[model samples]
Target: MADSRSGRSDSDALIRVETLAKRYETAAGTTPPALNGVDLAIQPGEFVAVMGPSGSGKSTFMNILGCLDTPTSGAYYLDGRNVAELSDDELATLRNRLIGFVFQGFNLLKRISVADNVALPLVYAGEGKSERRRRALELLDQVGLAAHADKQPNQLSGGQQQRVAIARALSNHPRLILADEPTGNLDTHTSEEIMDIFTRLNRDQGITVVLVTHEADIAHHAKRLVRFRDGNVVYDGGVKGI
Candidate 1:
């Protein structure tokens, strides 16, 4: 996709942030900025893992990237459009069109069927019921969970529920996937299974994946790793050797 404002092609960075920072206000006082002057760029189809301990600011950065939170300073460019300049509705539309999010929790509704859960995003995007069902089943099939389409969330294992979440994230055919500790709730083998699906999506389908995980083993699955410390990015490089 080309950016009308900058006239940049798809070869340009899909996500770019310059000196990005965010701070939250507490009842006592203003807390320290969660992110402080971080600069980074992610190209299309790149799989990057973000790692940091509690209070390290990785989650804050991911929230900003996902358009779930606003930065207090600096600029974030998604597909060459400045996030700081977009209105709330524009941000919502951009998020729905260009980004998919997967969280550690399955976040499935117990009242809904697995296929309906996968189709949730489509519902928000104003898709017809039949079309939503079609897309949901196709995505479920991709994640190896088509057989469970008629089941409820409680009927599936943690891993299966997470697969349903992944299918939901793909419903809009988003260019970027922001996954926050996607395997945190799963066991070792189940974590591996989820990572395998992510790897296949990034490699075969050319989807850009930015995942935040505290586990070193989970970070290794990504081609590149970004480590945060004390509200700053201390490391950004290949996954090997920490």
Candidate 2:
């Protein structure tokens, strides 16, 4: 874990990574570095996109940022906290408290109502049923799905299911939203609507968003773009450079 006192220059950055590296031991006496000397800083309320070819380490980077995995070396300060040293259970708790994830697939339970699907994370946090229901309803309304609360996930269209997924991701009021190919399964129009929701969350609620995609058009929706190639960040700059 990277301590706050370790090479942290920007006092206001929500995410700070310096000399971050990850490696895995394979065959005898050989180690492969998934991320080699990666340095990045993401500010509060910023929308950043990570673009890369297959096996370029974008997925590994997202895992580290979301606290799902730890780096082999270097420092990562998330919201001013050094999460690299946290225990597995502590990391899980921190993830639940600070990060919301949106994957390409909605990943909702088939038999549950849209409201119940959105409330699953809250339920994991040990909230009471009534409180969870109230918050779920609030999020559904926020995502324009209050009318579909009673419908099961199977009953919804792809776009509508994604909206429910977005609402569910906001259930805990997370500080960071980690989206991996969030619009991969949607058409252009639906993808735009999803990006609009992400933009609103970042601009209106100050939530930091980190999105991973291979498509240049999808990456353009973000203000900053980080490009990865061959397991390294070849470029990290504004979307204009994409």
Candidate 3:
């Protein structure tokens, strides 16, 4: 029964979008707007799920939230700073410092050891080699993958690989996690295990989680659900009775 409207004060919101819209250009001409007049506010330490059918604009909205794409018009603010106002370098730094990304593909580097792969983000942040290795091992331990740290990606099962991916995502100690179909490729049991990990992270660490999923059961893991249809949010409320 909580108010689901995006009318919360901007000063307290961790993420906010106002009148957001996006359009894609095709060879024929501009396509209809992928997103239209969307308004949302996500606070820190909350878990939210987004659901929609194909081409319903859920993916577009996630991309914009992740800073991988921009809205053609309107405003997006992250951590109290307007996204459009930051320079490219500043944006990159902000993203690195504030967000962690998890994807369906696992996205681990097959060429490296699991620990090294987890350490990749620290490398970009310019941590020393020994320090990176130490931190990577620590994260691997947190994910219950410490025993597999020296092994290559191919040596692990799909679920284990995804655990490594989750560990890697946490390497930078980001405050927010943006997960896009994180359990899509896993089997039902494996998917549940992955979701459990995410749930623990949110509950124990107070990290804000925003996830996109097509499955009702998966969306049920979140405390709040936001459903999109035809570039609009048709539902935004508690997950129960959805």
Candidate 4:
């Protein structure tokens, strides 16, 4: 873990990273940094698109931002808390409390009902089964999947499964939703549907969203775009999209 001066800067930004860097150690000692001197600030209610070629460090950036891994050097202040300084256990708790994640693969439990899958996080939080079931059904309704609450994951189409994943992500009522290639596996129409859901969540719920994608059209759905190249951010600006 990084130094905990409890050293922190006063920032109201939902996410603030200063000079972030991550380097991996390999058989040959160490590889080039996965992320190099990255500085970024994302405000609450913002939808950000991260784009880059393979190995451009976008994935690394996402991992760091999601608190799955720490930076080699730099400061990451998420909602005013310095993440780099948190212990592993503290990081897990913070992640469960404040970040919801959705990935390219739906990652739903195949054996469980859609409702149960959506309520899984609540189970970890020790909520009563009845309360979890109630919340899960409510979230399913929000995603227009209440009718499929008892359906098995394999019985649902790709789009619906992704929607379930989104519902599960929202299960914890996290402050930020981090999605990686969420539309990568879907058809164009399905992709749009997924993006529409994200748009609505950001617009109606004011949840900060950061998504990484390889598609330019998909990235355009976001209000802001940040492009990375060779471990450096080559572009950061507003987009014309809503």
Give the Cα RMSD of candidate 2: 4.0
Candidate 3 lDDT over 1-242, as tens digits, reads: 55653556767889999999999989999988889899889998889999999899998998889888888999999999999998888777766778888988999999999999999989889899999999999999998999999999999998899999889889999999999999998999999999999999999999999999999999999999999999999998999987
lDDT digits (tens) for residues 123-168 of candidate 4: 8777999999999999999989999999899999999999999999
State in Å the error of residue 58, model 1. Answer: 0.5
- The CA lDDT of each predicted structure is 0.90, 0.87, 0.91, 0.89
**TM-score ranking from best candidate downward:** 3, 1, 4, 2
Best by TM-score: 3
Candidate 1 local lDDT, 1-242, one digit each (tens): 11221444443989999899888999999998899999888888889999999899999999999999999999999988888899999888877878988999978889999999999888889999999999999999999998999999999999999999999889899999999999999999999999999999999999999999999999999988889998898888888877
lDDT of 2 at 221: 84
Q: How big is the positional error of residue 15 in model 3, measured in Å on the Cα after superposition?
A: 0.4
Model 3 regions more than 4 Å off: 4-8
TM-score: which is higher, 2 or 3? 3
Q: Tell me how many residue pairs clash in candidate 3.
A: 0
lDDT sort, best first: 3, 1, 4, 2
The runs of at least 3 residues in candidate 4 whose Cα sits more than 4 Å from the true structure, single-residue gaps closed, are: 1-10
Candidate 1 residue runs with Cα over 4 Å from true position: 1-11
Model 1 root mean square deviation, Cα atoms: 4.1
Judged by whole-model lDDT over C-alpha atoms, candidate 3 comes out at: 0.91
